[model samples]
Target: MNITKNTTGIESVILTSPDPQAAAAFNEAAFGLGARLQVRAGDAPTSGFRGFTLSLVVPGPSTVDSFFESALAAGATTVKPAKKSFWGYGGVLQAPDGTLWKIATSSKKDSGAATRTVDDFVVLLGVEDVKATKQFYIERGLTVAKSFGSKYVEFAAPAESVKLALYGRRAAAKDAGVAPEGTGSHRVVFGGGLGTFTDPDGFEWETLA
Candidate 1:
């Protein structure tokens, strides 16, 4: 076995947009994602929910609002406004590049002040068969950190990189405040530390350089 080969978690994420430069600028302005998140130009036919979401889990409600507002100022359309929920506080938006994003926190109150930092950067893949896809990742050397039957699965990742999760496709769309129907290329890719292969849901993973 090639033990040196990584086949577990994501190292980075790339979004394909019609205007790569504008997309990269939006990311820097809204999230300050730096190099971990990237963009390239590719305008393949895609509409509605693209079967995934990028979420920024922040520290507090204040931080959530900060990111949410920044996204709006960067020309993102609001899918949901920043508001308090039973789980905490958060909001959803679609970037000009056509990527859905959620900025959120578990703290209802302010801890200190808002920052452009993230407590957790999550890539949630909306798959048709969560249980089967979860099993596929397991066989590919991904260790499950959390599992919820056929509904959801989360994989462990290095602390400095992004986290990975799986969710039901339709349910993911509902959470994103969009209709649950889309076709054509997902227009996104993952720089997984793992070697390259496409998942059951058609999400692509590339070997991290």
Candidate 2:
């Protein structure tokens, strides 16, 4: 049997925050992510860049603006303001709890009325070596959907599951407009069918069952 046949890329993501209640409230108010995003009480000491950023891919520039504006209104500080680029429109923001969020879209203009709807949620983990981490996830049954040499890798995930990707630490931080230096816990964990195996960068994962 092909052991990788039954692999589920990423079933769930749990954020370990120092203030669970506040984190929960802020997330709900900001994005209404529902059960798609999870949070729990954690005091694991961490500082500076947490080595990851969550991305929200929306329908158009309008939708991107909707999320970007709301996140700012809900206590998120601007890392990069929403703006149109050659690829599309997007921006980065840091939540009150220090989570970096990237809201973006590939369309330069709105096709319809603007609404706060999200098209995709991506978890971008920053590692020291993209090639090594990509190989590691591949060995753990994650099928690579898109790859850009050693600079980045995007994994295929089940529908409704959060998408996973890997990027270099400095590049990921630069994309989020932050310093690359960091230490201590990543303060996050993933639950999936791949079982419990921490990535090379020290991000933890637990068995879904």
Give each model a TM-score.
Answer: 0.94, 0.94
Q: Once all C-alphas are superposed, what RMSD does model 1 give against the true structure? A: 3.9
Q: Candidate 1, residues 19-74: lDDT per residue as tens digits? A: 99999999999899877798988999997789999999999998988888888998
Off by over 4 Å in 2: 1-7
lDDT of 1: 0.87
lDDT of each: 0.87, 0.87
Across residues 147-175, which tens digit of lDDT does each residue of candidate 2 receive? 88998888877777888989999999999
Once fitted onto the true fold, the runs of candidate 1 whose alpha carbons sit more than 4 angstroms away are 1-7
